[model samples]
Target: MDKLRRVLSGQEENEERGLTSQVLDASSLSYSTRVKWFFICFVAGILLSILGTALLFIPGGGFKLFAVFYTLGNLAALGSTCFLMGPLKQLKRMFEPTRLIATIVMLLCFVLTLCAVFWWDKKPLAILFCVLQFLAMTWYSISYIPFARDAVMKCFTTCLS
Candidate 1:
């Protein structure tokens, strides 16, 4: 009960601490502040993603621009969640057994998309990787909602049958 009150009031525990703990406490934003920043980052991420998609219509180097912006947007959106759950906790949750594969695949696709666009200069490959990234990100995201993954799988199976 006391801990919950502290959390709700955005106060840290008055426990014995070390330098690292002190630093983290000093840098930690209040709950409301964290939520505000999270919203800002998430909205910017969505806007960037929309702009990137619109850029797909432009000729010559458009795909490259789209890939970069899209990847950055996804990264920003992912990072925004860290504000709600601190970065360490977010990382731990991301690597948990239930979502581990989805997380890894999503990150890998992000890297591959940029590599295909900038290094390989292969528009088709970049597009393919971007599609994969979208799918992976969707899977990873639904993991956070209870039974969402199961529902998605059931829907796909029913469609196939």
Candidate 2:
């Protein structure tokens, strides 16, 4: 309870692991670095997700493997979005609102996935939700590409200099 309280209040510290604060501050990293990491994570997530889809085409009992890849990809994408939020929020003026929308879309996808998996009849709705989720993810990724591109250029220039 105490630990939770401290973490919630943003006062937690773990010195042994060399962690200074429990709270994450986006300003701690350079904008370009943040963008680069975001890009890497996003690409990884997309690749994993595509691989998961490919697994779905397998003829026999690939559900488990498909689930594994799908879950991993989703988690990666979600994690990347969250990780970039701090830096993007600080560096970009338009990120906050769009982030909110993306979050909501993901949440809806979650609910729909659960409903579709358990209820059987709602599978169509789940399919629709999946499409919506894909669009949201695509939009979120595309919107942030500029920041990552700028960061790459900055890094390239600095290396040349």
Task: For each candidate, give its TM-score against the true structure.
Answer: 0.87, 0.50
- Output the TM-score of candidate 2: 0.50
lDDT of 2 at 7: 93
> What are the per-residue Cα lDDT tens digits for candidate 2 across 1-161?
55689899999978443244434431366767867887888789878878877876787644434445665676577666545656345335334674667656765675665466456545456556666767766555555666754676588799999
- Model 1 agreement with the true structure over 1-161: per-residue lDDT tens digits: 54578889999677767998876777689999999999999998888888899899899868878999999889998899999998989999999999999999999999999999889888889889889988998999999999999999999999999
Per lDDT, the best of the predicted structures is 1
Q: Residue 139: error of model 1 in Å?
A: 0.5
- Candidate 2, which segments miss by more than 4 Å at Cα? 1-27, 30-33, 63-68, 85-102, 118-126, 139-161
Residues forming the 10-long window of minimal summed lDDT in candidate 2: 17-26
Error of 2 at 42 (Å): 1.2
